[model samples]
Target: MLTILPPSFTLTDDSLQELLLSSSSSSKSWSAREEACYLIFFSGTLPVLPGSHTASIAGQKEEEEEEEEEAQGDPLSESQLTSLKEGLWCPDCRAALLAVLSIFSPGSLAATTASSTSTSTSTTTGAASAVEARALLLQVSREQWKDRTDGGHVYRKRYDVQSVPTVLKWIGGKEVGRLVDEECADVDKIRALVQG
Candidate 1:
């Protein structure tokens, strides 16, 4: 609906450029090229349609009936969807997830359990939080990626991100501060500088 609508809800190129400029004002860690790619894929004009109560009244009534029918039938579980949404909405969480996705595959994470004795390089290294974060990354779907794009956000594409340093550079190190705790990482210092 938003895609077909006029430039009201979607971001314009000028607005996206301004957003990038403002973001770059903080640190030189983000990749302008990557950001550009993100904008090209997701940015668009907003919807110009006006709301009409009468026009929507019949649709709402039909939707309510459908909802009631769905409620009577087997309802879809939303826990996974909710978790994915939270992870995408939270910058720090998404950054951390990107780092994890860089290292491990979803099948590997799902196959291993607390009781599993098959130890791997990813499972053996770093903090448990890091491991768990990676596990969560495997659970995120492409639909969530679309949602992030709709939110005017960019994510570190697993294949595009070559290494940790590259990922750091891609998002601009300044934004990296959001991923770590104040005590754990120098987020304040990162925020003080602009990135190219």
Candidate 2:
């Protein structure tokens, strides 16, 4: 069974301390051997989208409000909405991550497992089984770029990640593949890398 370690930021201070202690001690609780496949997402490269803003014109406030309401009533196209969500980035790394998660999340895996078992006498193939196995997903914050020595520094150094939006694939603690920056924006490419 593969054990996916949650991101450090998500853990409480006590849990983090315990995790650190366990990691540092000779008897490692979370071994790479246990979870052969892992995916690390360096999220620093992706630009943060600005919060929604409201502007008021001194004289034309009512007219501007009416226009704004009309504009809001007309929904944006899928591509336009995606572009707006992605902000300055050409490709949406966050969207790509969400896509990957949708496919490989625990819920999806459970569904796959149930379906495979319920089907006729066909046994699960190695590739399919591997796909069914949940891969560890870790998100490294963009703030890590500011302090190179902290916040996933070990992984950053090990993977030779120079920028954000880098997705590194590891099997048995060894890096098997990587997709950097805009390259990681493709869901098909990510699926191929993970399955490959």
Q: Identify the candidate with maximal TM-score.
A: 2
lDDT of each: 0.26, 0.43
Reference-based TM-score, model 1: 0.20
How well does candidate 2 score on lDDT at residue 161?
Answer: 64
Query: Model 1: residues >4 Å from true position, as ranges?
Result: 1-8, 26-37, 40-196
Which prediction has the highest lDDT against the true structure?
2
- Model 1, 1-196: lDDT tens per residue? 0011111223334433444454344333234443311211111211111110111123355753454344343211234223432534334333333222222222212223311322223332222223211001111223444453543223335233211111221232123322222211222222221122
Q: How close is candidate 2 to the true structure, as a TM-score?
A: 0.44
Could you tell me every candidate's TM-score relative to the true structure? 0.20, 0.44
